[model samples]
Target: MEPLFRLALLRPAIAQDPDRPSVELAQQTDFQRALSAASGAPDPRTGLRRVVGEYVAGPL
Candidate 1:
């Protein structure tokens, strides 16, 4: 979650950089895909725990 938040916060900076690599873009895309899947699961608790852990531990 922290990673997502940090990524969101850094989006403008990343976008402004024309040198951004395709691998990094792909990684972001993959993160979003995983997040989307997690969001749709019946038990959101696990996702919540992940968010909390990330918030506390500063991303993994």
Candidate 2:
């Protein structure tokens, strides 16, 4: 069928080797740590909102 042929073309080809080290490295890296290190700062949108909201909310 034409649809089956199109679906086959769209499918991602998986690597034949299942135990690649690049896959392990991708899993091991902490996404949050990587983001923080790259920016040298906490994410501004969420962090800024929390800081401003705390001032408005007052001591709990």
Off by over 4 Å in 2: 1-40
The best candidate in terms of lDDT: 1
List model 2 lDDT by residue over 9-32, tens digit each: 999766666665444533433444
Evaluate all candidate structures by whole-model CA lDDT and list the values in order: 0.64, 0.57
lDDT string, candidate 1, 1-60, tens digits: 689998888777544456765555434554565566667878767985675565567655
> Which numbered prediction scores highest in TM-score against the true structure?
1
For each candidate in turn, give its C-alpha RMSD to the true structure in angstroms: 11.4, 12.3
Global local distance difference test of model 2: 0.57
lDDT of 1 at 14: 42
TM-score of each: 0.32, 0.28
For model 1, state the Cα shift of residue 31 in Å: 0.4
